[model samples]
Target: MQLQTPHLTLVLISLLSLNCGSWAQSAFTIDSVKLTLLPGNSVESGTKVTLRCDVKVSHSFPQLSHTFTFMKYNTIIYSKNSSQAMVERSFTPARRSNSGSYQCRVTIHSKEKSSNTETLTVRGLQTPLLRVESNVVNEGEKVTATCSVPEETGPLQFSFYRNQQMFMILTSNENSTNTSVEFQESGESDLHCTYRHMEFPDSSNSSNIERVLIQPVTIIPSIKVQPGLEVVEGDRVRISCDVLGHSKNGYEVFLTDRETLLMSSPSSFTHSFEVNASSSGRYVCKVETGKTEKISTAELFVAELLSRPVLSMSPQQVFQGQMLTLSCRTLNINQERITKADVKFELYKDQHPLKEGHTFNFTASQSSNGNYTCRATAKNITKESKQLIINAKVPVSPPVIRAVGQVIVGKPFQLLCESELGTLPISYTLLRYQRPFYTLTVSGPQRSAVFNISYINHADEIHSFTCQAQGGAYSRFSQALNTPVIEPVSKPELSLGFPRGQTFTEGTDVSLYCSVQQGTVPVTFFWYRVGSSRPLFTSRSSVTRGEHVIRSITRDHRGKYYCGAYNDAGQTQNSEPVTVGVNLAGWKKAVIAVICILILVLIVAILVLFLKKARTPRKRKRAVELSVKPARPKSSDPMRMSLTLDIEDNTAVNNTPGVMGRNVWSDHVSDSESDDPGREEECEKLRYTEIQPQQPNNPEEVALVVEECVIVNSELQDGTQEDPDHQTTDSVEYVQLNHCNQNPE
Candidate 1:
């Protein structure tokens, strides 16, 4: 315990020294050290000013010594020991070099520290520095002015004052020290800027004055050429300039190639000029608006024009299936010189493009026979040559001559000539016996011709015919052919070989012959009815004779007949109508003859009977006729006599009375004498009564009557006949069955 006190004291002292060392390394500082210029922070050059430095430290230590040092822009000018911690100095006029940043230094215990920096700006009004972007700018270009005050706290508003008037205003951002303003420089203007603080609006200072001299701005015109940069020679080219945003009336546009002027116009934007060999070069367009000028340049090339093309054919006339060669040539002019390598050729057939080459070759045919032309082209120029016609004529073969109809006398015929596989527009001629008969030209490829012979006569038999074809420059002929024989037909005469006069009996043979005097052989005969148009019979004969025969004739064969003869040459007239008559059958004729003979016999018998009757006596005829006459009753009587025929009495005349007996009957014979007393007339009417002795006075007659009565009574007593009803009138008995004959003498 006794030894620990000294060791503790040593340890405490060592720790105090270590704490003081650490504090001395980091705690040494200069406080409240200031360097100021009397009156203000800023001043003009050559001004009287006072410079002062005040220094202070954070801790006062007995061992800590203080010294104050004043410096001007990092160069020490005064040093002093400031027991009072203050020092002062003075300068009558400050130099421009002394107007930079200044400082005050405080040193303690051999360690020195500096104060915050302070700046002093000593400015002189002698020609403030002015920077103009460009003295000669465009009229609308911006001209900026920057006014600065050194080392001043400011949110400055800067204004451009032109000729003492505010031309523009610009406000800087808060706490910003930038004092620049921009103004459009137009015409002549004296410009300057004044920058003032936000707190002191009226307290401001101007920068150096500047004169912004502006000239008229000329816009660069856009220029271009029409029809592109490549142009054909002798072609018109248009060069145009668009002078936009400029006055249109006062501008003059000039177009040129290199230094040579091509065209110039006032107040115009476009100009047209012909391009030639001399026009191919760099072209320039200059636009002058008042005193200002702008220009643009371009390069142009002018191609030469092509000359007319020439076409040539190796052979003018070519045959079919043969090679044909055609050549085309043209002159290509370039820069006033002709060159063939620059030109191209085109061949045309019938105005249509055939090929594109200098020479063309192909097998020729009929379709290739047309006009051919050539065309040449160089750059943009074209020219056509004269047309050349090609003839691909094919040789014509022998013509085929054909006869269309039969070659006979008095008949028309047609001969045709055809040439196939030949070229078009061929001419043909038909010759008879080497003489030209007809000539014709065919327009199309069908090469055919026809000739008509109006009438073929006997003379044609000795003639020969031929056909010829001509195409272009070639001709061909066919072999001769002999003409055909021709004979005419003559009228026919029809004859019938019959014993009867043109008449034939049924079931008999008959023949008709038709003969022509001057007709061809192998003639055909036609038999027709007289009124009919169709033929009833047809016969072919080797000679000029035609015959028709009928083995058995019939009624149908009886008609008017005519015959016609026709040969290959022509037809003859029909023969006259021959009336052919057909007789009836044999049995039919015999029956008609028997009937006629029987009629004659009957007529003769009738005549004989008439003669016998005529030869009889008239009295006997009257007695026979009166025997049948009836006795009519008198008018006062209503009774009539009736007679009945006795068929059994063959010996008596049993003939009934005729109409004449009835007409003159006894009833119609009236006794007119009884009705009229004027005259006495004997009544012819008689009645049947018994024949008595009429007059007793005549006894001889009575005696004869009695004798007759005795004979009658004796005949009656035989009883061969019965007595009729008898009547007794007055005192006499009458027999009604008997009549007295008027002629009973």
Candidate 2:
């Protein structure tokens, strides 16, 4: 029963959940949306049309509002929010501008859907009427052309055509437009007009053609050239222009050679001119009356009278200080009219007149080089020959060769070859060891040529480079260029004065030698310690080897050592590092030895005196005791003390000035008098000696003496001994001996 109840509960809950899900999913959904064009997708202009938007939607709710939108060319034209799904707009008369892509969109809540785009095309335009003001017109006379579209308005572009070719276009807001055009020739032309709506470019139509007739001018001009149209240069020629028909309006006539007006007169029609080669062309005669003009043409040929003088030069190649001759020659001429003597000749250099003759002669110097031409004139006609260029060659002087910059072995460098005086183009050859290795031709005002030498194999070997320049028939050689090449310093070898595996002692002089296998002179040497960037010593030497000496070396000088060498070649080469160790100086060792001996001797003397006292101590009831007072607390103070021995009461007391009435063994006495029961009182047998304090000349000696005494006392206190008294006695004796040694005076 329990299981069945649980299953039934699950089933009921699932059913309810599914129902809620279905309602949520179907809250708002668009089933379909469509845009339709009424009266079909394509229709004639002025026909009634409609754009409709239809949408179908499904919703869970009983009532849901939706928006309907209609768009043309992606721009919304109509929109409405309503419960209904269908919406529409109508155009009473469709216009060409109403043709385009249309779309509809429907929105419900947040859900929206758009319909596929549909196109509407309204085609048809009114045909324009073409008209002309006159059916017949004279050539060059303007006639009016009118294009009208009575049914259409609003800025229209109208195009007018003549003989099927459009010649003019105009825009007007009126239904009719007109323009004036002229025909250049007398011929019948077919004229038409076409108009397009500015708002809807596709709305265009053409009108029927109109025919117009053109008439020729009444007065036609005739041109006649006297002496048949052909004549030699420098000959007189006359041209006449006359109207063929008589005119009461008194027409004017013009005579022209090509486009240049020679004569224009209403009473005179003849023109006389001396013809030259430049005057040969078509001659035109024109007549004008009222708005009409007529023209006739006649071609004239003017033969050259002296056949263009030709300028020539003797010995095509001219050199400085040599004679040069220039002559003018002519192939043909009208000898019957003009003789050789009748024709005058003149020469010009660089546009300046030089001489007048058939031939000219001058010395070819630097000043003579210029552009030359000759002129021949006869019968008021002049002709010039083609330009002749003259450049007198100057023999090349000795060329100079030099290095551009510092030369280094195994590197590319440039060498320049130049001449002080020479005319380009000059050929240059570079020689190495008297053998040509490179050649080049230089021109265009560059006086020098540069040659790049890739590399030199040997730095020490002598190499000579020379350059030769040739401008004319002969070549000249430059002086040889010789310069030493710089060599980079080789890796240096570092050596210490001490033998291998031997340590250097402090306060000894040591030398560090650095040498290179091969390098340039004036080499610079540097000494450095390992793990350091700066050099300890630096020296410049003319040889490859260098040395650095350290006087009175100290432990501070201990570390790794290395050397570096560099020359003009700019590279510093370093040697492998060598380790150096420094030991203590010999004088310090000797001082330590003397201190040990003094301590040993004092211990032996104390034992001997104790043995002597024990041998006779029982007979004499009093015991002798010696006590030494230590110096001041300063570690550097000399161990100066006074010692005295007492033979009564077995007690020793120091009577020194600063330590009077004080027991020298005060610490030991305090221990003996302590309350500890384990200790037993014994007879005092240790002895100490008193030595007087004395001032020393050297403070270092006093410090050494103090140090020795301190060492002896510490050793005695720390010694493992069966008898504490014996150790105490030894320390006292050591102090006494050290004081005595310092104050022997």
Q: What is the C-alpha RMSD of each candidate to the true structure, in Å?
A: 39.4, 19.5
Best model number under lDDT:
2
lDDT of 2 by residue, 1-745 (tens): 9879989999999999999987776677788998889989999978888988888887666777879888888898888998877888887777665678999888876789999899998888767899999989987788999999776656788999988898998999888999998876898999999988887756466799899999877676788888878898877888888787655656788888776888898843788878888888988888877667788999999888889999999878878988989999777888878888888999999999999998988899988899999998888888899999998988888998887886777677888899888878889999998999899899967888999989776774325789999987869998778776777788999988666435889998889999999878889999999989899999999999999998999989888899999988788899998888888888977887898899899999998678546534432221112223232212342322233333222112211122112123222333323333332112222223344544444665455445444443443344315335433432333424336332110
lDDT of 2 at 344: 90
lDDT string for model 1 (1-745, tens) is 9899999999999999999887765665666677777756798866766777777667645445568787867888788875676677765575343456778888766677787777776664222234566556555456545555443434556666777897666676432222333333347777766665554435455777878676666466677888889987768988886665675477777877777877787754677887765678887878775445777887888876765678998777667877889999864466454467767789999999999998999988877889999988765566789999998868777787777756666667788788875777778998877888889999864557878888655645435788898876678898775555557677888888644247778998878888998866788999988878888789888998878887899878888888998887665678887889998889878998998999999999898677446534422332222212124334554333322211122113312121111111122223443355332122222333223212333454344334433443333233222212212211111232222222211
Reference-based TM-score of each model? 0.38, 0.64
Which lDDT values do the candidates have, in the order given? Answer: 0.65, 0.76
Deviation of model 2 at 177, angstroms: 4.6
Q: Over 4 Å off in model 1, which ranges?
A: 1-306, 314-317, 321-391, 404-413, 458-463, 480-489, 497-503, 515-525, 531-535, 538-547, 554-559, 565-572, 579-600, 617-745
Clashing pairs in 2: 626-688, 641-691, 642-690, 642-691, 643-689, 643-690, 643-691
Q: What is the lDDT of residue 487 in candidate 1?
A: 77
